[model samples]
Structure formats: structure tokens, C-alpha cells
Target: MQRILLIDDDEQLGGPLASYFQRYELALTQAVKPSAGLALLREEHFDAAILDVMLPEMDGFELCRSIRKDNDIPIIMLTARGEVMDRVVGLELGADDYLPKPFEPRELVARLQSMLRRRSNSQVQDTQNELRFEGLSIDPARRSVTRQGEAVELTGTEFELLHMLASDSGRVFSRDDILNHLRGHEADLYSRAVDIVVSRLRKKLEPLDCIKTLRNAGYSLALRRLP
Candidate 1:
């Protein structure tokens, strides 16, 4: 069973969601406060996390940032319905995905399943060779990236986006294309999310102009591959 941590202040939300998740082979653990949630994350092994925007102690964005500091666990942020800025900020903070509040339990399960599947697929396909560029080295099997001989910490989503571009260096991937590649579906908000992820990626890969924007076209890997 896949283990998931949910950090939300809704006192009554946890019990029902936990019961629903069980039917899909997901074990859900809940933390009503950010402190408790952070503690649980530090102490336990969870495959992914679900964080609500209106969390206690700190908001979900802050919690996500804190987690990204040391962990690469996939995170799904729950935002207020129709709150575009909330979703955008969550993605900017390194959330892998987001579901608006008052969501269907089935949809949440589907999202969790999709994330787990992607992680599994990446592990299987990325085991053989490491991709090397001028100043970047990507070990797919280890899911590690090094820039300029220094290890660069990246969220799961960031790593996946980098790996995708590296696999097809110089290919101009449109925002829609990137969103589809990373999340397996296209949504209106996802296009903007792609841009945010790319921006974050560029900063992490700083002083290395490896990703280039193509005006109205898309983005491409601009690095010279080391053979």
C-alpha cells in the first residue's frame, strides 16, 4: 500500500478521506497542524503529501518549501476552488500537482495513482545511462542531478522536467507539451504551471544557460552534450 500524508486543518476531513483512500490501496495519515505534519514527514516514510492552502502554523506554500529543502517527495496542494493565484503559487513553490477544494475522492485517488505510476516508470526506464552535458550530469536511476560538479537539490517535478528536456535536447517543448509530458494531461492552469516550473528550473541551474526560450515557440535544452 502506498503511504500518503495529508496536512489540513479540517478537523473532520481526515477520517473520511482515510477511509476512502483504503479502497484504492492508499494509506492516508493526517496532520491538522503544520508542525505535526513536518514532524510526521521527518519521522515517517510517505510516498507523497497532500497539503491544504489554509493550514495552521504556516500556509501550504511554506510547508511545501520547507519539505523541498531536504525531501523530494511528490506533493499535491489543495487550493481553494477557483483560486488561480493559489494554484499558481503552489506550483511555484514546487508542488507536483493541485486539486481544488471540494474535490471528489475518486479524483484524488486517480491523481495519487498517476504520480506513483510516473515515479515507477521513471525508475525503470532511467536506470541504464547517465546523461551528460557541458556542466550538467543526470543520473536517471539515482534521480540525481549535478550542475557544475555540484549537487543541485530539485523537487520531484523539477527533476522530471529536467530529465525530459535533457532526454530530448534542443527539442522545443511547448507549455502544453511539457504539461502533458509531466502530468499526462493538459489543463488550462497547467500551462502556466509549466512556465513556473521552467522558471524555477532555470534558477536552480543558474550560471548555466542550458534552457532557452524560443519567443512564441517553446523551450529547448541549449547545452552541448558531452559524449
Candidate 2:
């Protein structure tokens, strides 16, 4: 069974979620605080973690970063607000995805399965192990990125976005296409979702002008620098 860590103050959310996930053979380990979640992470190895944005002391964003500090474990954040800004912030903080509260339990399970599928697919590719572009290197097996020989930490979603663009360098990817690649399908996402992720990604890949934003068209990878 796949072990999943769920960090949320709403104790009620745990019971139903746990029962629902059992259908998929996924086990849920619940934590009501950020500190407890962190401790659980240190004590056990979970396949993925789910965090709620509104937590005592440490918010989900901080908890997300705290987890990313040393582990590449996939993360999905739960939020009651469901605002575009909230999703943007969570994604910027390196969350693999987010689930709005009062959501259909089915949706959460689907996303969780999709997230796990993508993470598993990234490993053990037969064609190649790494994507090289100019001064950047992406190792899918390790889920790591390095620019100019310096390690660039990326979330699961960010790594997927970068890999999509770098794998097909110079190809324009419409917002829908990018969203489809990042998520399981082309969702009716707040258009800003793509922009925010791109903006955040740009900041991390600074001084290296590789990603290009085409007005009225889409985005593409244009690595001007040669490795």
C-alpha cells in the first residue's frame, strides 16, 4: 500500500479522506499541525504528502518549503479559500498540486493518483535519463536540475514544466498544453495559474535566458547559451 501523509488541522477531513483513499490501496497518516507533519516525515517515508494552507504557526506554504528542503516527496496542498492567488502561492512554494475544500472526494483521489503516476513515470525512462540544454541539465531519474553546474531545486510540477519545454526546445506550448502536461489533463484552470508558475520558474532560472514568453501565442524554450 502507498503511504500518504496528510497534514490538516481539520480533524474531520482525515476520516473521510482515509476511507476514500483505501479504495485505491493508499494509506493515510494524519497530522493536525505542521510540526507533527514534519516529525512524521522524519520518522517515516511517505510516498506523498497533503497539506492544508491554514495551519497554526507554520502555514502550508512554509511547510511545503520545509519539506522540499531535503526531500523530493510529492506534495498536494488543500485550501478552503480556493482562490487563484492561493493556488499560485502554493505552487510557488513548490507544491505539486492543490485541492480546494468541500471538493468531491473523488477529485482529490484522482489528482493524487495522477501525481503519483507522473512521479513514477519520470523514473526509468528507456529513451534517456537526462535532458541537456545549454548550461542546464535535468535528471529525471533523480528529479534534479542543475544550471551552470549549480544545483537548482525544483518542485515536482516545476520539474515537469521545465522538462516539457526543454525536451522540445523551441516549440511553443500553449497555456492549455502546459497545464495538461503539469496536471493530468487540460483543466479549466485560472489562466493566471500558468503565468504565475512561469514567473516563479523564471526567477529561479535567472541570468539564464532560456524560457521565452510569446504574446498572443504561448511560451517556449530558447536556450541562447551553449553548454
Best by lDDT: 1
**Candidate 1, superposed: residue stretches over 4 Å from native:** 186-189
Off by over 4 Å in 2: 224-227
Instruction: Tell me the tens digit of each residue's lDDT in model 2 across 97-139.
Output: 8888767878888888888887778776664567777788887
Candidate 1, residue 86: CA error in Å?
0.5
In the predicted model 2, the residue pairs found to clash are none
Going through the candidates in the order shown, the clash numbers are: 0, 0
Q: Which stretch of 10 consecutive residues in model 2 shows the poorest summed lDDT?
A: 184-193
Q: Report the CA-based lDDT of candidate 2 relative to the real structure.
A: 0.84
**Residue 189 miss distance in model 2 (angstroms):** 2.4
lDDT per model vs. reference? 0.90, 0.84
lDDT of 1 by residue, 34-128 (tens): 99999999999999999999977899999999999899999999999989999899999899999998998898888888888888899999354
Q: After the best TM-score superposition of candidate 2, give how far the Cα of residue 104 lies from its true spot, in angstroms.
A: 1.7
